[model samples]
Target: MSLTISELQALFFGLFGGLALFLYGMRKMTEALKATAGSRLKNLLAALTRNRFTGLAAGTVITALIQSSSITSVLVVGFITAGLLSFSQAIGVIIGANVGTTVTAQIIAFNIAEYALLLIALGFLLEVAGRREWLRHYGMVLMGLGFIFFGMELMSEATRPLRDYPPFIDLLRQTRHPLIGILAGALFTTLVQSSSATTGIVIVLSGQGFISLDAGIALIFGANVGTCVTAMLSAIGRPREALKAAVAHVLFNLGGVLLWVWFIPNFAQFISSLSPAHPRVDGCSAAGRRNASADRQRAYFFNIGNALLFIGFTPQLARLVDWLVPARAELDQPVQPKYLDPYFLSDPTVALDQVRLELLHLGQRTLAMVEEGLNAVTRGGRQRLNELRKQDEAIDTLHGEIVTYLGRLSLQNLVEPQPRQIYEYLAVGSYLENIGDVVETNWVTDGFKRLESGVNISTSTLRLLERLHEQVCRSGKITLEALEHNDLEQAREVLRSKATYNELAEQARTHLARRLVVVAPSRLDAFRIEMDLIDHFKRIHTLFRRIARLIEVSVSDSRKTSKSG
Candidate 1:
């Protein structure tokens, strides 16, 4: 008999609503885990990608911690864009992420739908009643797990009627064909944007006796391929490294599936032998539980096997992906912010790390301007001065981008010391920008004035200014190194150089003072220009010290915090 309208509504609402809960729960769980482990995760990913094997382990552990391979993929892409993780290292992580994602399917296979409500209630109580931040986070984790299981229960209940529905049974029978099952699985996963969801649904169908183990295996294979869409979408408008990483994900998943497609029956039989039998009940049966177990086992086997197959070929794979996604010519044209990836803003710790890297980029550019500005003022022609001025414009553009990115970062829900870190970065960015301003506004104008008035500085004064300029540039470079490596000693070294710079400034002033009396044509103008240059260089020196001091304070605070923890 044909189903009535009410029955159809029940099925539609239950399935869709369950999916909504599942997605929301997954999101909630992922967010809570990320907030709890964001800093450690960043450190782990950065430190552990020494080789393919370690990278694979790191990827699997991180994905398991957060329970979302999509998020892991996003993190990998962001790290690649920031130059924290190389593309080849990211490929290994991508392989491990596939294995990590199978944990969700394994969790779904347990016979715990009956306790989903209890978990929800306890999670709610803990979330509302707990006083500590971490307690609340754990509570959310529990709630998220509850929602996932509850969603599966809802889906399972909704499809119960399908056991007797002739049309539905016929459709499920078609899935026995490997290609048809794979297609359906891939399409559904693409629409949902979650392989776990597709896996969950497949388990539900198997439990209800709607699909056999062979079809379930095919659908699981397809889900692996479809899940790559998340990584690909994230890589859009990102750097070529990110695109290469995404492409690697696609190749690995698709290749693994292709490797095993023809062995579905054998795979199914092997998985069946490994999985233990489950007793039949009113809503679920031995076959259903067995199929669910087998599907999850198959995922583990598929991803781990693929990781082993490709782990040794990472260098080759990276080369192939690089060849596939060639670099654009415009990569070197503009001075855009290299490390300020918007994807990282979701996790403030990683976002702050990106900001630090961008600051290093900004620091290098500003230091170059300082060195060139000195040359333009003392020994270079009008053309060189104009070029320095243009370079300052680029500095201003980069400074603005850093400030805007930090402003956006400040809006995030920052943890302890992160708020202070943001302020420090803002201060450092402004200082670096001010150094560029010193070059363009003060030093560059002084150069123009010197050129226009035909003021000729004696060789002695030029040599003195050059020495001071060298010292200033050296200090700036050291400060940048401190910032880049978080080296406390380097920061302290910059601060300690203040006395030496002071002596040099005093000597330059003394030399200029002695020149004022015996000067020839435009002699007074020459004295003023040299004095102005000395003063501008002193100003730049002071800014670098200020930046160094900020680094010193930041490093000290971090050490203290670490000790306290």
Candidate 2:
């Protein structure tokens, strides 16, 4: 039988449009769910992925609620960024997403087409009639459900002629060729971009009895590989850790495809022998073609089987990904803020302006480290020190940023006035950062070791110190604001509070010092802990002084401006 171009055109448009509708609906549903879920989706991964079991359960429920595995995976990346879950913990979540995604297949398989219009009307009502997030959620769910069902029905109707078209059947026959079939499936899913949609089409075609089990399984395999593309796209501008997550997704799916390709015949027999029914292909008559419908059901099973096969290896697979793209090593040095140049200033004047900005940025970084150190001694079971190192890195990054900006500025031929202003800013930035170092130097790295090696602060003393820490943080904030805005009034208040907090903080030390000398037993560790908290408050006071100085300089500058004016 000769094939007409119009028949091919009809088939192409139908498939393309069906796939488009499926993908578009998936995107809308994903964004709406994420928006509605807000930070709760983010917090879920953080609290949930502590262990593989929890991770899996969380992933399943979250993915099911979100209705898109891609959204679930991206949320995992956010959790990782927030330091909520480690890369390893993310593995089970990804694996669970596979199972969660099957909800789409199950939903699509239901005969909701008859109710699509009614469902859409209800969805519109919910959308127009509600201030509640749950109602909005229900509205989005209804809309997605309506769209998916309607699109599937349109696809089925449009492709009805393919059942009788010898040429169309001949093309579908290529699905029996594992490479050709897998490639076709992968390409279609990649282009249409939803494994669920691809799998849904397989169900519809199988139910129609137009494609055999062997063809369906090959496409299912292809759909698995195709799913990774979205993750890969997300990794474009992200850090290496993010890239690894996407890579893990790819490697996990690709490995499954490779394993199944070798055992294709065995897998095919398993899927086909089950003869799971495809209700779509049974459109002609539910009583006829039970075997073909079974083959289609097996097609879906093929996807699940492969995902199950890989889920076991998710942890082991994470290790492989780690080997391929190792976690970036922890930086050993205190990074200067100068290293973090915005690098935006290409012109001499602009570069100088950037240098000044970096100087401020650098000061801010040091201020953060000082802030964290204040908490480390005062807060119980201070988080892993390395975790607090981000505060230090923030300082170092700014130092590097400023230095780089300065170097670029120095290379340029600056005018008389700007050069002095740039130099003064650089000098001020360096001085402020030195204060940051003084604060850093006060951090008892060994002290924490000596303390946690089991030194206990008395309950009364601990409570007093906690209150002191609170007061010190206030002083720090006040000082920082004063300096940042050059507010002399805030600066004086910061200094006054610093003196008051220091006197109180110092009194605790004096009591410790006297106890050590008289009635105290030589629990030198306890003494050190008391002194550490005392010193923490001391550094807080010092940060305030520096900020006060910044305010003083700014005030003097204003006076000079007044004189010039």
Candidate 3:
């Protein structure tokens, strides 16, 4: 039968509307699930195994809970890119992801569309009016589940008219050929960018008696291959390991499809034989019964195929994928924050650990700046002075990066100890940045000015300044060590030594003023410069001491928290 323009528009409207609700509900459900188990999930992902079976199990459980294989694969790619997972370990996760996606198909097959509206109403009330945050999140999960079924209901109703439509019947006939059905499945999945959606649609059509078991099976096979698109897209601009993960996903699906393509009819027969509730293929069965049978059979077959292919070929497949995406030669990049991998941002603990490591690296770089500044002043050379200035700039750049990274970390819901650690890191970074500024702006600039003015410091003054600089440098090194190792005693010692450095500075100043009077009148400029340098060394020591105090406080707080716990 032919339909009017309005009927066609209604069909399109229903189909698109259903798809919109379905996608939105899936997103809501996925996000709520993640938020509910955010920390636990992060820990699980972080603890991925090199063992294929363990990796597979982890991937399956995570993806099944989240209701998205593509998401799982993307996470795997990110972890691999961050050097958190080995290439072989990632292969198993990708393999398991394919199986986990079948959970959606199984859920759809349960045929719970009748309760969709009631779920929506209850979910809406709980989400909008519930007082508790967790209750609201639970309501969102229910709302997502309702939306998914409601959308499917709408699409199923719209497509019912096509049961009598000749053109649509002919298209269903074409899908009986494995190649045509496979292509159709791939195209539909690619358009929606979700294999689950494609599989749901297939179940809908099969229930309506618009498609046969063989065609449905073919479509499912193609959907598996099509789902790889999401992981592949995620790999773009990522590291070499990420690209390998994407390639592994593609290879797994492609290999599975190519291996099973010839057995389409046999697979269909196998599914049909195993489905106890499968309705007769004749046109006598009700659409609901037909769909129920079709849904279960497809879900079962999808699970079986993924399981068999992954389990049997995991080791060989891992090797093949590794060979296909060989590791590239390492690039000679500048020394920067290697552990600041963006992927770890999802796990606050992991992210914080990385940030702490980068901060330690920053501490080392800043110490280098201090050394360079001392050499620049003591040796009286423009080359060392210019290098010192450049190192200071580098330190400044690193400090800015660290501050920005810490700011991003602050946006996350951090645990108790995390906030304290973050604050301590921030304070340390600020102090180091200030120390770099002093070394360049005060020491380098003033020393250069003295050189330009032809004012040479007296030998006695130089010796005194060098001794103080050396002491400050040693203290700075000790403070860094204390911070890095969380050495409470060492930090305390650094704090206690501050008074000694202060007295030394005072004694040096008194001695320098005495020598100035005995020196020639023209040497007054040099004497003043010497005193200024000594004052800067005292200030630098103060900054270093402040860092030590901050470290001590952090350690003390950590101890108290542990005791209370």
Candidate 4:
């Protein structure tokens, strides 16, 4: 078991150097894929539904592309918190994430270590000299693949000496005990913060003749259990719904591990049957053949374990999580965007979705503020007037946050239509804020000033203003609806209704002017009050028109981009 200082240094170099390279490769590959496919992935995730099968498929696709279940789980938690996904649907995606993660093990099992240098050279040439964007991204992927295999090869060589080391052999034997093996797997994955890395390392060890099939399967079980740590840490301080999603992830993995712990022997036997030459058999002569079988068996073991857990426990797990985490009481909560998760900003498409949701919330809040201001004007309630003014502060805060977040997203080299979409969101946010200011500053303050001047609006003038208020409220609702649904037809309707609204305002103004002439000379200030209020309503209408127009332009851009793409 004794080793020279040089030997110890080599071991450390091989293990740590290979691990660092592997992690770096994984990150680069995932980031490149995400940059290339960000929008498609965003759309797929955004379209997640209550159907378990659909969620499962979406989860698998996303995780497979990104090469990290942790990222997928973080996304699922954020979506759940934002109300984009239900607890039940998130469970299916989680299952798919587990299944998708197994793809890494499968890829590693190919044992293409000898070709690593060739891939590295090709990848470097394309990455450094390619003229196209796709060429560079694909080159990055190639480079990452090369680094991964090269690192695995190094680690395999480094650990080969362990086959003869007595102490190391004793430690590998302890892994034959399921509990000991699972604990080792969990502990190592927790430290690495990646199940795939831990699993890959175990496969490398297995291929090097340092671990048996049953021991490898036990370690795989532990890796699954340990990966939950990432999701749990992400959920801290997040919304209650997000916390529940994290809990469900932990629960699902733990339950599956416990259920499968007693059956590792049976599962290992089944995996061996599927292999060309069982690990227990002595007929296999080629080192490559033996290593390939071991690696493939480990991969299959990981995949099948997840498949069975998801298939058998999805329904029960869904129900159990729901019962465990009930919805919070929805009281008279203030109007705000429930789903504006800043974590989504990493993906511009998802971040844009968050902005859209936040803008919708801003619109809803603005509408409420307008309604209260109108009530104050019509009913002359001082308290209601103050409440509307206070609500504007919230509108301002949300507006600023949306703008800042979009600005951050814009800094990233976004894909087609995204830069245009950022401008649209900014325009919509500005318009929404203007509407709030109109209600609080223009309407309420002006009404108070008119009152201080001893001017009381005539009954006829009040009725006209009420009708105009109704029109403005309707316009706000329509604009919000069009934006939320991204309905081109609805946006067109909003555009067409502008003339009708103008006509209505013109008729009301003319009628008000005539009424002003008939008002007593002592009430001359009433004329100014009524006229100013009408002008304010017109300004509000103009802002809504701007929002509706932005919506229209965004939809058009989206169509053009889709066609071109």
Best by TM-score: 1
Model 2, position 176, has a per-residue lDDT of 72
Q: What value of lDDT does candidate 3 attain over all alpha carbons?
A: 0.77
Residue range 1-565, candidate 1, lDDT tens digits: 6788999999999999998888888888888887777578878888889888999998999999999776677678768766677888888998998889888888888879899899889888988999987788888888998999999899988878777887877787888899998888888988998888998898888877677788888899888878777668877887676678789999999888899999988887778788776322222334564556666787888888888998999999999998999988764576788888777787788778888989999999999999878777877898998988888889888889989999999988776678999999999999999999999999888988988999888999999999999999999999999999899999999999999999999999998888889939999898989899998988999999999999999999889977987
Query: Which of 2 and 3 is the better model by TM-score?
Result: 3
The all-Cα superposition gives candidate 4 an RMSD in Å to the true structure of 2.9
In model 4, where do residues sit more than 4 Å from their true spots?
45-50, 74-85, 128-131, 281-289, 302-306, 309-313, 326-337, 407-413, 519-522
Considering lDDT, which of the candidate structures 2 and 3 is the better prediction for this target? 3
Whole-model lDDT values for every prediction? 0.85, 0.65, 0.77, 0.78
Question: Could you say which candidate leads in lDDT?
Answer: 1
**Span of 10 residues, lowest total lDDT, candidate 4:** 280-289
In model 1, which runs have C-alpha deviations exceeding 4 angstroms? 78-84, 278-286, 330-332, 411-414
Candidate 4 lDDT tens digits, 1-565:
6777888899989988998888877877877777777677757877864588778778888988888776676677667655777777788888788778777887878878999888888889988999877788888888889888888888888876666787887777888899998999999988988887887798778777777777888888888778788778877776666667778778867877888889888877777777777655211123423655655556445555665657556678778877877778899965456666656666666667778888998899998888777668656767777877779988998888887788788887576668878888898999999999888888888768665776667677678788888888888889899998898877787778778778878887898778766847546677776778889989998898888888888888878878976
What is the per-residue lDDT of model 3 for residues 1-565, given as tens digits with 9 covering 90 to 100?
A: 7988998999999989998888888888877766665445545776765577778878878888878665575567656645677777777787777677777777877778999999899989998999876688789889989999998999889888887888878867898888998888888888888887887788778778777777788888778767677667766765566677778888877877888889877776777766665443523136434555555566456655666667667667778877887777879865566556555565465566567667778888888888767667755678777877888878888888888898898897665567777888899999998998899988898678677777767677677777787889899999988976789998998888878888878888888878777857547777767777887888889999999999898889878965875
Clashes of each: 0, 28, 1, 0
Worst 10 residues of 3 by lDDT: 280-289
Model 3 steric clash pairs:
207-291
Candidate 3 Cα deviation (angstroms), residue 74? 4.8
Q: Report the C-alpha lDDT of model 2 over 79-193, residue by residue, as the tens digit.
A: 5544567878898888777767766666676666789777767877887786875687678767766777777776777777767777677787777788987888888787866
Count backbone clashes in candidate 1.
Answer: 0
